[model samples]
Target: MDIHYRADIKGGLLILHPAMGIVISGKVTIGKNLTLVGGNVIGFSTGINNPFIIGNNCSLGANAVIIGPIILEDEIKIGASACVIKNCINKGVTLVGVPAKEINKA
Candidate 1:
């Protein structure tokens, strides 16, 4: 399991096992205690100057793709195989599926 992170992390970051392939670009900024399940990609530049931001205590599942210049608030959970291309305005929410939509965990 090889994990490559070239971003600015404010605190601790844990990339879990079974990490098939993980890549974090240099244009991203992550908060404290980020739990990455593996096989995930964060912030791959596509000529976009906006920086990708991740909040504290966030968990990104396996095969999760969070690209572009977007902001994810604190305590967010991104499900496996999820592709997020937008900003997560609310804090402490769960996002899943392609294009990544916020779901209510009832």
Candidate 2:
């Protein structure tokens, strides 16, 4: 199955290297130069009012799930299968694991 929702995509967003599966639901805003790998699921955590906002030049690893109303700044890198609940990450950083911790500043 082609795991991508072109309809959910916005202007100037790029999805690349999807190695597994990608399911896009809810309201998602992806900035320019953004790349999502296969297995990266970008959508809402629940039937809430907020959605997910990914910053420019951001890269999501395979199986990474970004949910809720959160802000991922530019140049953000997410590890595979990482679960991001609700938080704001600074630019040039790498997040991993459940609840998504700031592993390193890239």
Best by lDDT: 1
- RMSD to the true structure for each prediction, in A, is 2.1, 2.7
- Model 1, clash count? 0
TM-score of each: 0.88, 0.78
Tens digit per residue, CA lDDT, model 1, 8-76: 888788888653777787778899999888888886658788768899999999899998689999999
Question: For model 2, how does the per-residue alpha-carbon lDDT over 3-68 read when each residue is reduced to its tens digit?
Answer: 345424445556665446667764677777767777777766565675467778888887888875
Clashes of each: 0, 5
Those runs of model 2 whose alpha carbons end farther than 4 Å from true positions after fitting are 1-12, 17-19
What overall lDDT, based on C-alpha atoms, would model 2 receive against the true structure?
0.73
**lDDT, candidates in the order shown:** 0.84, 0.73
